[model samples]
Target chain A: MQTEQITETQKENKKQSTWRTAVSALLIFIAVPATIYLGWKFADRQHYIVSLLIILYSMVPFFLMYEKRKPQARELVVIAVMCAIAVVSRAAFIWAPHFKPMTAIVMITGIAFGATAGFLTGAVSGFVSNFIFGQGVWTPWQMFAAGIAGFLAGILMHKGILKKKRLHLCIFGGLTVMLIVGPLLDTSALFTMASGISWESARLIYLSGLPVNAIHATATVLTLFFFSKPMLEKLDRIKLKYGMMGD
Target chain B: MDDAFSGYHPAVNFIFFIGAIVFGMFFTHSAFLCASVFTSMLYYLLLMGRKGIKLLCTMLMLFFALSFINPLLNTQGDTVLFTYIGERPFTLEALMYGFVTGGMFVSVLLWFACYNCIMTSDKFIYLFGWCIPTISLLLSMVLRMVPNFKVKIMTIAGARKCVGKAPVNGDKKEKLQNSMDMLSVLTSWALEGAVVTADSMRSRGYGSGKQSNFSIYRPSVRDMAAGIIMLFCIVLTIICAALGGMEVAYFPVFILPEANIITILGVIGYTAFLLLPSIIHIWEEATWNILRSRI
Candidate 1:
């Protein structure tokens, strides 16, 4: 009688588990295809859905890794700030003698903050700016590239690879980033915008745009050099006022 | 490490994240047409399935609305769809074109939405963090800062309103002044923030060049496999995209209708690969949980 009861209980548990698995799997399959198809159809008119999805997707890895740290008020504030700066910076790019180098600014901000903060700044800046300037597939690339740049700065700063005072170090690092990785982003944008242009031609176009690229690098370094000291001083004052960080 | 973020490896996130963006960059020209077809198929496949015929009908309704409204407003096409206000002749070709273009436009936006869902900001940072530190750091800061700035603006704006000197709406000058005021406040705050950060860094021996350590998240075998698949898909997509497999230029001519096999194949291949990982992960997780529960 005891053996029978145990078997019965085990069977019930297995049945329930199977049911749950099937339901979850079905839901995922349904959700994935539905999103892609719906997203594909309304992609032009209602691109917000995609952006919404991306924002939601970001929470996935976060959720998977940590059960306790929920998205919060303070964190939301940071996301908003990064977005605004990104927009402003992109707009500023249009006005710069060439294009105001923004990677440095984003990098600096990320270093000061943390990883998520840095990534958001770059991503948001690219996103907001693109929305204002143009609405194309290239916008996502910009967001990713710019965001990556900022995120890199944060990680390196954390690791002591990048320093505040070493303007040359920052500039060289920023330039190297642009020269190697920048091309891929440039090519991506070009391919999307003007697909007819051969990859070779696209490379030439990007190469020709070197002046603008240089300006971007120079502007970034100069801005950092001029602002870092004052900014640090002010940050110190804020820390004192808020007592957020101990001396 | 201190519990600010989960232990998800930034490196894997970055790789996939960039891959996603690169994927997105493949869809620039056919914006309207491609988006339209993709969205229709998406809605039908995801929602209606074999009964997608009903969804297609709904899609037609949407297409009619967009195309009809578009030419009436845009009036750029050479072929007239109809006569709107007497002198304004809307050509049939134009209306149809508009309809297709509108569909494309909508579809492209939807595709981006899906792309965003798959590739996120976290992934972007993780991939590129090592190569470009300062920029990456600043980006993160900006992400955090944008929200901060918004709060400050709202608070200041609210306080001003309460004082009966509301600075919400006005002419350019007033708006400029309001912005200037905001900038002043922001600058003051930023300066203060900078000082604190520098002090913190200095104390932490940031520039000490002691080969500071970072909690690197090495890619697991699964992650590597996933990365390889993503890279391969992107490469194939680019090649196809470059060969005009996806291009459908309007005005002079409208080539490659949805019925075209090559175009259909490209669309299918791209969509399938794009959504592959998420599908697999979701499936695997469900299975794992079920087995665990059973145990």
Candidate 2:
């Protein structure tokens, strides 16, 4: 049965490969130059193009997770739930300015599910939570920031960097999430929302973000330290019993 | 409340959102940025009344703090304001740049709140549905799921409070345990609902074949007209930007571009775009008031 399922998925993948290659070629040869031309035509069009590209490129992973895997209904539901949980966890810590549990949740989702699932969780949560926090030009930046953390987490898990040792995971998760959310998000703000300041002044803001980034890192570590083990164990058992994706 | 802007086709609202966000962030000219800020404040007051004013005050405080911090850390410009430590010069250029940057930030931030008021989730789903249906389905579900999770958590907390296990009334350790218990309960509850959703979706043939979109928004003649107006405004704004009519160079020295006729025309077009919803709102309110008084 497993072999049959694998073959079916492989056939589906083969069928789509032609169009996939065509789309990528179009992006490379035509779409990219066109975007650049439009960007050069305007004064501050580069940031919008860059952000729109991140989301559009993220489609590769989105396809890998859904179309390639042909994830079962149950797995899709689980991924969506993980996204909801991550968003609510961020709100759960709303009183704390820089302490964000959503990063830890994204890390756990990536570690437990896979990188694709992790990226989706982070991106979805970032996008959804802005409804409460208010959506702006920074919404895409937040999505990219959180999504990178999850994508990195998946790489860590695949490479056995996340194996057994909880301390290593905490340290790595803290630093990566903070770096992405702090410096990256800060710079995006400078470029997209507040480019009146010089690049040097922008760098100053990034440097000053260190303290808050440290707090964010600490929150990731503490949340994961307390909660990740049980969640991972549960996910493992679910995979074993139900043959879920990433099993 | 049934707002006037929300009554438009979702595409129209989305176009306006794109216009406002792009134009608000794109132009760095002091007059343009100030106009954006002023319009944002006006819309915010119309949207959230006193709460919006409070946010405006907060943004002002942040602006001054950022301005002060900029000259202290970044001594890059020519016109020195004051010197800190031994040699670092607080330049007038840096200060003005900081002020303008702060204005840009506040304007974008207020526009976001304004977006929240105008572009409801239904509107968002309607916008994305045609292009990426599955993703929009997931997004709309997520929109529903977030508020549902909050309400469910509150219910769980209320139930726990009755049992003397609520996080609110307990000592340190107990409160910690209660919060954990609440999280775990929420996790389980979510998992249960997810499974049910999965089954229902499967039974209903979620991924069977190409499915048509179920959109509640339709493009009226008014939407078409409004779309053309927005497109014209955007084209005008872009031409103005490309012509360097809205230039405000602040690197070596703070400078405001000359507000010539072309720049003034661009400003009018852009202001009209940003305040389109507000205009619709005022028109609706005035007509309603007139009708009521006649009655």
Candidate 3:
């Protein structure tokens, strides 16, 4: 009887997983492209609104997946602790301009936890920190960028492409910031502040942002190089002790 | 000095700000821009008083810098004001476009500043909790954890100082190592504490049933009135924009809408929406003074 009940529960879990997969696939493959097409077709002049909507919509699938899992209170607390650490570390490095451990910390959370948790940690930190640093038009874009960084970190680690080694983690962290987060922020500035969107203006905006991106990338790389080992070990110990977030 | 507008329902506050910010972003007409910037400045001053002056000045500098940068990058207009390096023609139309864009940017920023002052964290959570409960709970948890971690870090640092491991006037690498050690220690301590917090929450029956939220805000009759007025103004302005009453073009040549009744009314509606908060505050102050005089 117990064996039969276990099989039935496993089948139910499989069904739910398939359903989730279908929904996520549909959202990514159809809904995202539809939003982009409609946005560009109708709101040509209002790129800011269109881009903002795209970012918001892209985040929905992750949130839905996280909610469906019914995470335990311990898992929620762990994610919250990671976010707080990211925010506090940002504050702690205020004396050094463009030198923040936020991205590295988010990436470490991703490596230790999973993608959804990583994204939540990054997104929440991006948001709550702005309450202290002052909210602005760039808040949504910043949130999206930071969340994507953590998401990518989680993905790479899961795929075994990104190891726990210091060099490997540092390279991934640096490249992600330079290629992803930095450009996303510059794109926000381009759409919002620029009088007109042109190839020349876009080039100027990206070019102007390059130096800042380099500094940010360097910060991420340095943070990972110096701290990833100890942080990962600490996180592993907690995971073992609590048996929480065991993906 | 407390603003009367902030005392309204969060829904009212949220709607008013969304209307102000969206219209401020979309409209490029001189009248709309002027109304937005002027009213936002007034409200920001009312909210922040003397402390706002420094940020206001910084925004002013940013506005000028942005305005100047636009003409340099965009050489689109026909009316050449001057020729610069590489024969880049600085045009009158582009300059005007820059000013409008800069004005829109600054006004939106000012409105956000006022928003920060009015929309406290609890108000934000109250508004969003129902829509996204998990994320909202996470936000609340993170907010709660940030101050806790800060206190813990201080305690740890103090303890480390007692043990002679505190960071001193050292080289860059030494300082970096010291900070990293502090962070690692903080992380371990926080994670350990977090497991206990989670267990405590579970013991308190979290996730055992549907959750109920408690909020102090309730929409009153005045909030309803304010909401109705704001909705009417927003609808009016949006209709005006859709009808091209607020249209302006500044590409090859500058174009402005002919001043008609609809355009005038649109501008008035926009101004009224933006000025609602300041008006409420001033009116409340006047009433209080009258009552105090009678007393």
Candidate 4:
């Protein structure tokens, strides 16, 4: 609220001018993957903590640089509410193990709100829900995995791709969950359990974890394909009617 | 809600969890991990009674699944069990590591469950509220709001049922439309509440005042003494653990830990640290029972 000028830049970034879009793409495809490989190659003895913290901390600068204005109080509440909804969405599907609304809710938050909001929602949901499900060494890994997906959703929104059609949104959401989230989780499982970690073992971990990952991906697509348009429309209307989110 | 440690200092709860969760994650000692899991479950049972059996069942599933999965993914180790669906040999070492890791995860989860009871959302905010005011406040709000939101959604779902518009019972298309309507209702309701909350917070000078907090927990002499003991025990355990006496090797070969004077001392220290809550609960329960009998 104190600073009003920054919002213009952030909204512009949302449209994702060429350089900014390139930077966003680099963040996912290059920066993150390189960090993972480095953490794996260097911190072999304690890569569990090392890699997780590296990925988590990498998120901070993006949040700082991307913010055009300080998030308004109401905007902060929106983010928190989105996070609460994401976690609560998990509870609704408790009977079914891998079927969850979390990833879809997160991506929608990004597409509707912005990158920072989406990332925060994902990271917070990962953490606070872990408190409900129980926290463990896997917490940081989950936090980053979810946050990255939301960040990419922001990029998707900026490129005008997510809103292009409902089908594209569902496709992007499903692929991100299936490819990124699953592999990140499986790698963490490998690092925690395996004595000597290697690329082959990482691949096998992915292979073995394929069954659960598929279910998770399918669940993501099902929720997004069905729910995203309606949810985003509601969120947009709320933003307009309440004069919240500086929309 | 039989809160055994309700009156205890928050620091005691904080220190105990740091010890349990950190040690549970850190040391690979089978004895210590088992102790962490066992005592945490026992503590849960003591505090929450039969409500804990379901949690125990979940923990058991996690434990077994982990043990089974690890051997399949991992192809290391000298002694190999039967091969998997393919050429991947199921190694005993991998299985052992999985067992230990699963134990660690369960132990951490149980300790956190106890933590959610001991250090409630209010108490947790109290502990860190002043330091990280913003994040702590948000966390407290989310924690409180999530369960409340669930109830409200359930009520909305029920109300929809009366109108023959239940999300659950509708055809796929109708269900989607019905659920979206309820979701919109929820968002609007939440925003109205948020506005009121922001107003209330502003009225309290939330941003302007030098906030002074009032806490009911006064650390008694008993708390101080227990805190000192816990500190000493943690230090001793760390020293022993650093000396390479607490855990066995689980890779390339599953070598059992050597049992000697140092390892035994380490085990005792580890046991004591993990058992802090359970021992306190038993002591409290016994004393309370005695007091009731005398009365």
A23 Cα displacement, candidate 2 (Å): 5.7
TM-score, prediction 4: 0.78
What is the TM-score of candidate 3? 0.92
Model 4: runs farther than 4 Å from truth?
Answer: A1-71, A90-99, A136-138, A155-165, A192-204, A237-243, B50-99, B209-216, B250-261
lDDT (0 to 1) per candidate: 0.51, 0.74, 0.85, 0.73
Rank all candidate structures by their TM-score, best first, as comma-separated numbers: 3, 2, 4, 1
* By lDDT: ranked, best first: 3, 2, 4, 1
Candidate 1 docking band: incorrect
lDDT (Cα, tens digit) per residue for candidate 4, span B1-295: 6665656788888888867876666667777677788888888788778888998998899888877776766677989877757667888898887787677667777887887777665666678655444555567778878998888788878898898977666576676556656665666677668777766776766645234453677889988988888888898787787676765777799887669877888888878877777787788889999999998
Candidate 1 residue-wise lDDT, A1-247, digit = tens: 8888768756754664555455445545665567667556533222334443443344323222211222222333334443564454433222224445356556655666655556666666776555345435566566666666666776877788777676744574457455734764665534333212444546555976576566666666654555455544554454466553231
Which lDDT tens digits does candidate 2 get at residues A36-98? 676656544355445555545544445434444556777888888888887886544433466
Query: Candidate 4 chain A: minimum summed lDDT over ten consecutive residues — where?
Result: A63-72
Q: Assess every candidate by TM-score.
A: 0.44, 0.85, 0.92, 0.78
Provide the lDDT at B248 for model 3. 74
* Prediction 4 global C-alpha lDDT: 0.73
Sort the predicted structures by DockQ, highest score first. Answer: 3, 2, 4, 1
Interface RMSD against the true structure, candidate 4? 4.6
Better of 2 and 3 by TM-score: 3
Query: Candidate 2 vs candidate 4: which has greater DockQ?
Result: 2
lDDT measured at residue B288 in model 2 versus the true structure, 0 to 100: 94
Summarize candidate 3's per-residue lDDT along B168-211 as a digit string, tens digits: 42577776777778888889899888899999999998876566
